[model samples]
Target: MDKSVELLKLGSKIRELRMAKGLSQAKLGAIVFKDQQSIHKVETGEFNPTYIYLLEICEGLDITISELLDFKK
Candidate 1:
């Protein structure tokens, strides 16, 4: 797969996992030290999240980096 497409898939997976954990974008943003718009951009694959940001989010969500990156299509 192309790199962009992979990143988008990973983003989608993160969104799904966050929703499953009952978190809104704003709520997740609070844990990640970002704003709602930033979270929204991540969920929508409109922005490529930074490594540190992704790590912060994963830690806050109690999930591993591998789990966040695993997407099935």
Candidate 2:
């Protein structure tokens, strides 16, 4: 797969996990030290999250980074 597609997959996985946890983008952003707009950009695949940001989001979601990448729907 292409890198951009991988980013989109990652973003979709993150959005799924966040919604499953009943979190708003703003709330998830607080955990990742970002703003809701940033989170929205990520979910829409408009931005690629930094490694640190991805780590923080996984931690905040109480999921492992590998789990976040496991886009099994």
Candidate 3:
């Protein structure tokens, strides 16, 4: 699959998990020390984040990196 497509899928998974956890973008962003707009860009797959950012996102979501990348649904 294309990288952009992969990013979008990952973003969708992140959004799903975030919603399931009852978290708003601002809340998640706060946990990760990012702005809400940054979270929005990430969830929309409009920004490619660094590995550290991904780790921070996982931490914010209270999920493992494997869980974050497990787009199996």
Candidate 4:
């Protein structure tokens, strides 16, 4: 798949997990030491997160990197 498509899928997966955990963008961002706008950009696939940011997001979501990238569902 294209890189953009991959980003979109990753964003969707993050959104799904965030929703499942009852987290708002602001809350998630706070946990990740970012802003609501950053979270928004992330979830919309408008920003390419750095590896550290991705690690922070996974940690904030209480999930592993493998879980975050698991698109089989």
> Each model's TM-score?
0.87, 0.88, 0.94, 0.95
Residue pairs in steric clash, candidate 2?
none
| Cα lDDT listed for each candidate | 0.84, 0.89, 0.91, 0.92
What is the per-residue lDDT of model 4 for residues 1-73, given as tens digits with 9 covering 90 to 100?
5988888888999999999999999999999899999998888889889888999999999999999988997
State how far residue 70 of model 1 sits from its true place (Å). Answer: 1.7
Model 2 C-alpha RMSD to native: 1.3
Model 1 lDDT per residue over 1-73, tens place: 6867876787788888889999998999998788999988887778888889899989979999888876753
Q: Which ten residues in a row have the lowest lDDT in candidate 1?
A: 64-73
Off by over 4 Å in 2: none
Local accuracy of candidate 3 as per-residue lDDT tens digits, 1-73: 6988988987898899999999999999998899999998888889998989999999999999999988886
RMSD of each: 1.7, 1.3, 0.9, 0.8
Question: What is the clash tally of candidate 2?
Answer: 0
Rank list by lDDT: 4, 3, 2, 1
Candidate 1 residue runs with Cα over 4 Å from true position: none
- Cα TM-score of candidate 1: 0.87
Clashing pairs in 1: none
